[model samples]
Target chain A: AQSVTQLDSQVPVFEEAPVELRCNYSSSVSVYLFWYVQYPNQGLQLLLKYLSGSTLVKGINGFEAEFNKSQTSFHLRKPSVHISDTAEYFCAVSSFSGNTPLVFGKGTRLSVIA
Target chain B: GAGVSQSPSNKVTEKGKDVELRCDPISGHTALYWYRQSLGQGLEFLIYFQGNSAPDKSGLPSDRFSAERTGGSVSTLTIQRTQQEDSAVYLCASSDRDQPQHFGDGTRLSIL
Candidate 1:
C-alpha cells in the first residue's frame, strides 16, 4: 500500500514571494507522483505529474515540483506566487503506470497575501 | 470534450434519507473515478470504473456507499440512510489513459 503526507496544514506568503509545499510518500514499488490545486468552490486541477525520466517536473500556472527518489518526496514550488494562487493543494501517489489507486495527502492550504 | 461534469451542484437532505450524485465524464475517457473530501480528510478515493468493470472498490468505507457507471459515460453514486458524517463534497474525475485526470466542480452534499 502507498500513502502520502503533507508536512504543512497551512502556509501564508506574500504575493510575488516564492513558496514551497512539502510532500512525502511511502511505497514499496515505483510510483507516479502528482500535484493538484483546488480553488474556492472549484474542483481539483492537475498541476503536474512525475511519471518517469525526470526528477524536476514543470507544470501549468508557473508551478513546478521535484521528485526525490531516495527521500520519497515531491515538493511543489513556485518562484513567485500571486494572490490568486491562494487555494488548497494536494499531493498524490499511485503505482507505476497508474496501475493502482491514488493515495492523496491531507493537503495544504496556501494563503497568498497581497 | 469540455471536462467532467457533475449535476446537482449542491444537495441538502435530512438525516436517514438517501441521496444520489451524478457525474458525466468527458467523451471517450476510458477511466473514471469518484472521491470524497471532508473537512479534515483531504481526498478519499471511493471507487473507480474502467469501462464497465470496477476492479477496485476498496476505498468504499461501508456497504451503504454504492456507485455505478452505465454505458461507459455517466456514473451515479448512491448513499443509503445518510448520516451527518456523510456530508462532504463528492468529486468525479476522468482520464484517457496515463494522462492527467480532468475533474468536475463536484456535488456538495450536505446531510442535515
Candidate 2:
C-alpha cells in the first residue's frame, strides 16, 4: 500500500514570493510520485511526475519539485508565485511495479496575496 | 482532443434516493478511474477499469457504491440508498496504459 502526506494544510504567500509545498510518502516498494493542482470548482490537473532518472522535475506554470529518495519527500516549489497561482495542490503515489491507482494526500491550499 | 467528460455537474436528492453519474473517457484511452473528493478526504479512488478486465473496487466505501464500464468506453457510477456521507464531488479520469490520468470536471452530489 502507498500513502502520501502533505505537510501543510494551507500556505499564504505574497505575490512574487517563493513558496514550497511539502510532501512525503510511505510505501513498501518503489513508487512513482506525482503533483496535481486543482483550481476552484475544477478537477485536478497534472503538474508533474517523477518516474525515474533525475531527482529534480519541472512542471507547468514555472513549478518544480525534487524527489528525495532518502528522505521520502517530493516537495513542490516555485520561484515566484502570482495571485493566479492560488489553488489546491495534491501529492500522489503509485506503485512502480504495476498498473495501480494513485494514493493522494489531503492537499495543501495555496493562497497568493496581491 | 477532448478530455474526460462527466455529466450532471451538480446533483441534489434526498438521503434515500439512488443516483447515477456518467463519464465518457477520451477516445483511444484504455484505462478509466473513479474517485471521490470530500472536505477532509482530499481524493479517494473508488474504482478503476483497464480494458476488458474486471474493475478494482477495493477503495469503495461500502456496498452502496458500484460502478460499471459499458462497451469499454463510457462508465457509470451508481449509488444506492444514498446517505449524507455520500455527498461529495465524484470525479472520473482516463488514460492510456501507464500514462497519467486526465480528469473530468466532476459531479458534485449533494444529499439532503
TM-scores vs. true structure, each candidate: 0.97, 0.97
Docking class of 1: medium
Q: How would you encode candidate 2's per-residue C-alpha lDDT over A23-53 as one tens digit per residue?
A: 9999999999999999999999999989999
Which DockQ values do the candidates obtain, in the order shown?
0.66, 0.62
TM-score of chain B of each: 0.97, 0.96
Candidate 2 clashes between residue pairs 3 or more apart in a chain or in different chains: none
What's the lDDT of the predicted structure labeled candidate 2?
0.92
lDDT of 2 by residue, B6-102 (tens): 9999999999999999999999888888999999777999998987564688989999988888888999999999999999999998888778888
For residue B56, give model 2's deviation from the true position in Å.
1.4
Q: Looking at candidate 2, what is the lDDT of residue B98?
A: 76
Model 2 misplacement above 4 A? none
Top candidate, metric lDDT:
2
| Top candidate when judged by DockQ against the true structure | 1
